[model samples]
Target: MNFNGPLETSALRQVEICDSKLTDQLRLNAIERSRMMDSPNEEVFDRLAFLAAKFLQVPLTIVSIVGDKKQFFKAAHGLPSPYDVSREIPIEDSICRYTLQNEPIIADDATKHELLKHHPTIGPWGIGAFIAIPMLTHDGQVLGAFCAVDTKAKPWTEDDILMLKELTASVMREIHLREKISELEDESQLRDKFVAAISHDLRNPLNVAKMGAQLLSDMDGDEEERADISRVICENVDRADKMIQDLLTASRLKAGDKMPLEVTFGDLSALLHSTVESLQKGHRRAFHFESEKTIDGHWDFDRVRRVVENFSGNAVKYGDESKPIRISVEDHPESARISVHNYGPSIPSDEIDNLFNLFKRAQSARDSKHLGWGVGLTVARSLAEEMGGRIEVESTEEKGTIFSLHLPKVKPSLH
Candidate 1:
């Protein structure tokens, strides 16, 4: 997934590209890592812009990060009314984007300059003279621009351009420092979450198994009761073991490792029908199956079964029990889709993307009377991608929730 930066603006296609770097994903990632776009103006950056304006004698100066949709003003000194208040403008209207070519833009008279003359905001904003210095990281990815603008046409001397360049370096220093700090904080939070999730989620099943064993040892029940307790103990032990395996898998996948898969020919339709039948025996919720007679594919059987069970388990836990949970398999030319759908409260739009993240549970899941470690979806996504597939989800009040896995018919590569 791409980083949708904070600016709520239009698409990057609106901007005329003079440099391919303007659309480079790595460059955009650097900008996102900086975390400077749409952020509150810091005194340190405001001071730099102020000093640039005063030293260069330009009425307006800005420190901006040019994003795909819009240009965000980290600092705007002496900027006009609405733009200063909003701190951003559509990418099509931004003259600062020209600096992404890794060169300083010096337009003495923008109205006559071939490149600046056609931009709509150039005339209305009374930008007669402007100089933009590209803010480049140490690795030479241009983030955006540090520019000085004047209402009246004027020539920039060498000394003035040199000073502005120095200040641009200062801007990049601050951005890089902030990026490092954010990375460190994220690492710390990841460690904390790992500790918390293991300690909390693993305790429930372990305690259940321990209690069942203790009850059996006490010999307070008859033979039938002892057998029941033994079965419960085994089930709880299996549950705990599965949780540990999922935790390890999620951790490895999160660290950018591909999961190992055992590929074999199988019938997806048969897989779903059998899995759903077994689930129906265990769960009170009604299970309905629909599919062609057979949907053949080369894929990992155990991983696919794991995903089916997870999706169906979620449906049983959260869906309205009165309504039947539907499981279906559809065969396409290049791929096959297995969907598990249930009627229940819909997932909120804001929380949908987060559902696949480690330890991220939907609001409905948190509010429901069900217990989950929230690692299932994360591991499911990794397994699907490793098998050259993806998971798609849709939820609405009228349509209910649907979780579908799209798998390639033929294996993409050896695991």
Candidate 2:
């Protein structure tokens, strides 16, 4: 959305038309990659747009992504339509076009500004003052601008531009994060297909390794050394097989494949405690599991166990070893709540939203002594959602980090 505001300046009176810039084509190309054309308002963008309007104390504000000839409003505040209705305007009528080509702009009186004076929006839209900051991509593409508008002439302070620039930066980061996630999801889908194809080819080789190890165990030999070697070989084979299976499942989930869960009625409490006990045997720290009684649920027992391992493993690896990792299973009327809480540094607010993003880790996690690819939560969340439930996360300096998951207690019967 294009905007005009009460804040005016003499700086843009004789400014060159935005079209005079040769980089318009490259800028348009990058804007196209954002996929914002004719898109509806997003909450993230809307918040910043409103913040820009209120902070500038202007009558209008907009977050626009400019394309070849269209200005698409990802969000807007105080904008009345056909501009709002269409959520786009011709680039010719968009003052934001200049902000893309050059530096951020200000026009104290649009009626006297050279290139903008005779523009189509001035008289009808009542453009008296305007200001904008460029929305830049990481690779240095100017996508568009976060702009404010007024219908009456006024002067704006340097602080106004600074605040708007900050808001634009915030909005651009969100936009870039969104684009990154989308790109990763698409890449994951392609990778999943490739994994599925290769998994089939590798299955026979894995079977041979397992069978060979088993044969060695059965053959006549010095029992002690032979048995130990056999056991090591079998263990490694099993581990490799499990890795393949996990990769197959993750790929399928990322590719939006439905899980063929072998659901059964079972006790979630028993499952959690048993898994923790097994892990505690090998893990360096203590695990405290709390459950008053059995909480029965119809779930994929294997999948639930996997989720527990992922959460518990992360806690053991990253959490303070001196503190016990806490896991609790509680029953809700229609669901079972399973939570894993670990004592550690709080996850930053900026990184929380990306916590479950595929192949992404909290910056703190990356900076810590622990290492991970950050796909566990994404997989866990998908499994929870597939089972007609959801996962939630909370972190605080005092309380540490907790991953809470609720799953439906009843599974719908399938034919």
Candidate 3:
């Protein structure tokens, strides 16, 4: 009821005569944090207060977390006069700081105990007797206290602390259980999304192949036209197979599969020429390649080919169709680099970091009409890293976008 702002700790002490009476602000902050990690369930906390109120025979049982400037009532059984078990009380007007900072308290009468007699709540709320146990985490952070209070003077026993301690354990157990359940539920949702993505990605190419097959069957054309139809069918089939292979490769990667040096070694120049030819045949774009005559590498040719195809495909998809997409291979003693460049809208620097993650697409690509499942770069990065190589990207308003893949020029020995 109309909780005011920042009730200065001045109410607790006057002109700071002695410092030992100070509250443990650190422990109080810890208490605030421990409560924030879990969702507050009134029913769960109410049960604690109910149990405490019944066993201790106190009219008021509150599960309190001491905050920076106020005491939060997480759960309460019976509190009166402008309050119940659920209200914020300024720390300066609260007496929780005593037991919360030190050992548990068993105040038989507030008037007798010097520490709590002058407390703002003592005369107003009639807090005659107080008993609280610190609700602690495994690492020993005092979250708050479970306490019982009565209006008339009373006595608290050792057995009361034990009972309250057991109850604190019960409440903490529920908190831990709820937190773990939330994590598992979140993970299950992510798994479902992964399955949906794989299904959609695989289905797209399969649908194209099926349509190509249907068109082929209805054909009554010359050899050239028939060959073109066959090419369409073949390209679709290859695309479908590529999607499946990406899934397979991703699984292997997850399972710790590695590519040996021998597997990656091949003719670098020839692969670039062939990959570009295959891509250009299907797309309405010009492809240009420049490379050393006799390039050698101990790199996974197949993996590199996937990266090349993805990079070149992105170029054609994003670049000016009237202009040419260029592929350049530079050979060095230590390594060889393949760069795919396209004239297109630039990608922002912040977006490049997450570009290779599975299911993550650059904002530029998402905004464009060209759509993809966003796994091609994922495969590319995996393959490159496994082969002891790296992939890099650069984009600008002037030169457009360029993706460069670096691989060892010479193959490593198995031994």
- C-alpha lDDT score of every prediction, in listed order: 0.83, 0.75, 0.73
- The residue-level lDDT of candidate 3 at 379 comes to 82
Query: Can you tell me which runs of candidate 3 are displaced by over 4 Å?
Result: 1-201, 218-221, 259-266, 320-322, 412-415
Winner on TM-score between 2 and 3 is 3
TM-score of each: 0.71, 0.52, 0.55
The TM-score leader among the candidates is 1
Local accuracy of candidate 3 as per-residue lDDT tens digits, 220-275: 86779778878877887787788788777766765777656446556789888998
For candidate 3, the 10 contiguous residues with the lowest summed lDDT are: 13-22
Residue 190 Cα positional deviation in candidate 3, in Å, after optimal superposition: 5.5
Global local distance difference test of model 1: 0.83
Residue clash pairs of candidate 2: 4-149, 4-150, 5-129, 5-149, 5-150, 6-150, 8-108, 8-154, 9-108
> How would you encode candidate 2's per-residue C-alpha lDDT over 270-336 as one tens digit per residue?
8888888876754647888899798887988777877777787778777777899999988888888
Which ranking of candidates, highest lDDT first? Answer: 1, 2, 3
For residue 174, what is the lDDT in candidate 2?
82
